[model samples]
Target: MFIPYCISLYIIKGNKSIYDPAFRLFALNMGFADLEFMALVGIFPAVSYFLPFPVSFNVCKVFGAFSADAWFTCIMLSQMMSLNRFVGIFWPGNAKAIYTKRNTTITLAFCWIQGLIWTSFYLKPNVGLYFDSKNRGLIYDFRLNGTETVFSLNMIFNYVHASSLCLTYGLIYLKIRQDITEPYRLTIFHHFIPVHDKKDVSYEDNILEYKEIMAAPDLNTGWRRKHMLDPKLANDRKKENKVLIQACVICLLHVAAVATWAVSQKIATAKYVLFIPSIVGLFSSGSTGYLYILVNSTVRQKFASMVSKCWCHKANQLSNYEARKKDSGIQSISPKKDNEYSELMEMDDYENVTKN
Candidate 1:
C-alpha cells in the first residue's frame, strides 16, 4: 500500500492530479509521515528481531522515541488536513487568504518539528528493554511505569488532538446542514444524531471550492484575505457531499479501530487477545495509505493505470525478448538518438523501481 500509493502519488502529481494542489501536497505529507512511522516500528523492529544479538537498550529507546514522534506527526498532519478541509468548506474565502503555499509548507515542517519536541521529553527514561531469547533480539516497552505520568499526559494530548479533529469536522457538518435547502432526515441503526425534514431536493450543489465564503466585514483590519477561484465546476455541486461521506468513513473506521484498545485496557489479566488490538492497529496503520485510493477515484484510476502499464510491459518484455530488443533499438542508432533512448530507458527504470 505504501509503495504503490507513494509511487502513484508522484506519478499523479507529475501529471497534475485532478484534486486541488493543497490537498494533493497535504496527502503526500501524510503518506511520508505514515511511511516513516511504519518503517521505524514495523520494518526496523522486524530486522532487529532477526539479528543474532540484542541491540543496546539505548538504541532501542531512540528508535521507540522516533516511532512515537513519527506517529505523533501523522496524527497532527491528519488534523491539519481535516482543518484545511473544514476551513475550505466552511470558510473558503478565508482559506484562500490564510492557507497559502508558504504557510502550508511551514505547517508541514512545524508538524514534524513539534512532534519530535513532544516526544523528546520521554525519550531518556520512559522505556524498558528486554532480549527476546527466541527472536534473538531486543524488544522494548516504550511506556515505562516510571513515566506513566508522561504517558498519561501524552494520552491527554492525543485526546485533545482527537477532540479538535471532531470539533472541526462537526462544524463542517453543521455548516453543510445550514447550506442545504432541504432538511433531510438522517437514519442510523447504530443510534447517532437526530433526524429532520424540510423540502425534498436533488443532491446537486454549487459547491464553491469552499474557500470563498463571505469575507468577514473587517477589510480595514486586513483580516483573512480571499482568493478568487474559477467558476464552479461540475464536481463542485457535490463537494460537501463527498466530504460528508469521507468524514463519516474515517470517523467510523477510527471508532472501530480504537474500540479494541479501550476494551483491552480494562482487564488486569486479559488473555493473549489483549495483544490483538495492537496487531489490528498496526495493520490498520499500514493500510491508512490505501484509504486515499478508496476515497478518491481519481487516485484509484491513476494507480490502476500505473500498475497495468508495469504488468503489461513486464509480460511483453518476458514473452518476446528479441522483439523487445528490436523495439528498443528501432527508436535510435545515432549517438544523439542513443542518448535520448538511454535517458528514456533510465526514466522508465527509475519509475519501475519506484513502482516496485
Candidate 2:
C-alpha cells in the first residue's frame, strides 16, 4: 500500500502524461494486492502466533484463502504489466489507442473479480479442511487436504505466468538488440557505398536536409530526437537493457525459489526451508517496482521532489511552531504593559512580512 501510494503520488505530482495509463493503474493495483496479501498471510499469522489469543482454525483458513487469492491476482497483474510493455515497444504506433485509461481500469477490475471468485470457492466454508493421515498436527488441515488441488491450480497459473513473462522478456530483448544493431548496420552500409567521382552538390544538400529534418522534434518531443540520434538512442536502450536483464534474472530466481518451495512442501520438509525460498520470491516481485523507477526519469525526479517537499514542509511546520512558542513565552515573561505587547505584535508582523 505504501509503495503504491508513493508511486502513484509521485506520478500525479510529476504531471507526466506520457506513460501508458494501463501500466500505471496496474502498478497501483499490484501495490494494493501485495499489501493485502502480506497483511493476510504474514502479519496476521505472526501476530496470532506470538499473542496468546484463542485463534480459530477457521480464521487461519480464511487468511490463507485471501492470501492465496491476492497473490494470484498480483502475479496476473505482473503479467499484464509485461504485456503492457510488450505492446509499448513492439506496437508503439498503436500504444496510445490500445492502452487507454478506461481499458486499464476495466482490466484491473476484472483481475480482482476473478481472484475473488477463485478464493471464495476455495474458502473453508465452501470446502472442508482436510487432515493428513500421518503427522496430522504438523500442517494445517486446509493445506494438507487441498495440497494437490491447490498445487494443480497453481501449476497451471505458474506455467502461464512464467511463460508469458519469458516471452515478453525475450521479445523486448530482441527488439532492443535489433534497434542497437541497426545503426551499426547502417554505418557499415554507408561505408560500403561506392564514392562517385562526380561532384554531386545536390546529394550533399539532400543529406544535410535529411539530418536537419531528423533533428527536429516530433509529437513526442525529445523522445523522437533521441530516437534519431544513435548515441542517445543507445543510452536509452542501455537503460532498458539493464532493466530487462535484471527482470529476467529475478524471474529466473523466482522460478527456482518457487520450485524449491513446492518440492519442500511436497516432501513434508521443514517449513523454514520452504520459507527461505518464499521470502526470496516475495522480494523478487519488488523488482517490478524498481524497474518502473529506473525506466522513467519523470518518476525518479518526482520521487526525489516528493521526498524533498515532505521534508521541507515538515521543517517549516516545526520552525513555525517553535517560533510561535518562543513568542508566547517572551510575551508571557514581559511586563503586562499594553505598549510592550503592541510593540511585540508589531515586531512579529514585521518579521512575518519580511519572511514572506
Candidate 3:
C-alpha cells in the first residue's frame, strides 16, 4: 500500500503531461482515496482484528466513519472517470473546453466536499460503524431511524455509479467498433466504375482503389486506432483511447468488488464467510496501484528510478559509516603506540645511565 501510493504520487506529481488535465485530476483524487482507504480503513482495522486486546466501540466507530468516506469518494471518482472517458470519446471536439483545468479543479473540490457531507451521517451515535465479532468484519448499523435514510442513500448511490459505468463503457465499446468498421462499409458505396474508366486502363485503377480500401487492416490491430482526418486529432484520439482502457480496467475491478459485496450481503452464510466481501474490497483498492505500475510505462520507469536511488543512497551511507569507523580505530591505535614508544625510549635512557 505504501509503495504503490508513493509511486502513484510520483507519477501524478512528476509526470503531469503523461495524461490529460482532467485525467490527472481524476488520478490524483483516486490516489487520495486509496491512501485513505488503506490507511484509515484497511491496515488499522485488519491489525486491530488480530490484536490481543479488543478495540473499543468508539474507536471502531471513528474508523468506520472514515472508511465509509473513503469508500464513497472512490465510488464518486469512478463515476467521474467514466464520464470523462465518455465525453472525450463522443465529443472529442469539445473535450478540451469541457474539461479545462478550472473545471476539473471545481469538480474535484465538489467530490471531496460531497464525500465529507455523506460521512457526517456516520458520525452520529446511532448510525456509525461497528465491528461484528461473529462475522469478523466491520458492519454498518443503519436500522435505526437516524441511519435508515443514509443507508438508503448509500445504496442508491452505489446503484447509480454501477449503472453509469455500465452504460458509458457499453457506448464507448460500440463507438470504437463503429469507428473501426465505418471505413470498410463506406468503401462499398464508392463509385466502382469511374467515368474516366471508359478507357479501360483507369478501370483497373478504380478496382484497385476499391479493393485497397476494403483490404485496409482492422483498426483493432492496426497502428492507427481511427481513420484520422487530421494528425493532431488522431494523436488526441489515441491518448483518449489509452486513458479509456486504463480507466475501464480499474473501474471494472471496482464494479466487481461492489457486486461481490452486494451478493454476499444477500446470502445467509457462515460466520467466516462475511469476511470475503471486505477482503475483496481491500484487494480491489490495493490492486489499482499495481495496475497503474503495470499498465503505465512512464510510471513503471519512474518507480524503477526511485527504487534504484533509494538503494544507492543506502549503499553510500553504509560505505561512509564504515570509512569513519576505520579512521577512528586507526587514530586510537596510533596514540597508544606513540605512548608505548616514548616509554621504551625512557627505559633505554635509564639503562645507558646505569652502564656509565
Q: Highest TM-score among the candidates is held by which one?
A: 3
How close is every model to the real structure, measured as TM-score?
Answer: 0.65, 0.65, 0.73
Give the residue spans of candidate 3 off by over 4 A. Answer: 50-52, 184-208, 211-238, 265-269, 311-356
Positional deviation of residue 266's Cα in model 2 after best superposition, in angstroms: 1.1
**Residue-wise C-alpha lDDT for candidate 2, range 147-198, written one tens digit per residue:** 5575567667777777778888898988877866566434533432334455
Assess candidate 1 and give its lDDT.
0.58
lDDT of 3 by residue, 1-356 (tens): 56776676777667666677797788878788877887765678678878999888888888878888898888788778888888877888899999998898888888888888877888887785655656766665645566656666777788778778888888998897776677534534243324253565665687776566557644332223232333444445555566667777777777877776666554524666657777777777877777677766566666765676677687764333346668676444332232344346545644553344
| Cα RMSD for predicted model 1 | 14.3
> Candidate 1, after superposition: displacement of residue 14 in Å?
2.5
Number of the top-ranking candidate, with lDDT as the measure: 3
Where in model 2 is the C-alpha error above 4 Å?
A: 1-15, 124-147, 183-250, 286-295, 308-356
Candidate 1, 1-356: lDDT as tens digits: 55865675575566443456676677677777777766766666678867898777677667767766776787778778888888888777788788888998999999899888966764756544332334322233444775545555656766676677678788888787664423221111111111124344322321221112223323332222111111132135354466556655555444444555445544414345444554554554566556656655555655665676687787774323345657786545333332344346545644553344
lDDT of 2 at 71: 69
Model 1 residue 9 lDDT score: 58
Candidate 2 to truth, TM: 0.65
Which is the better candidate, 2 or 3, if ranked by lDDT?
3
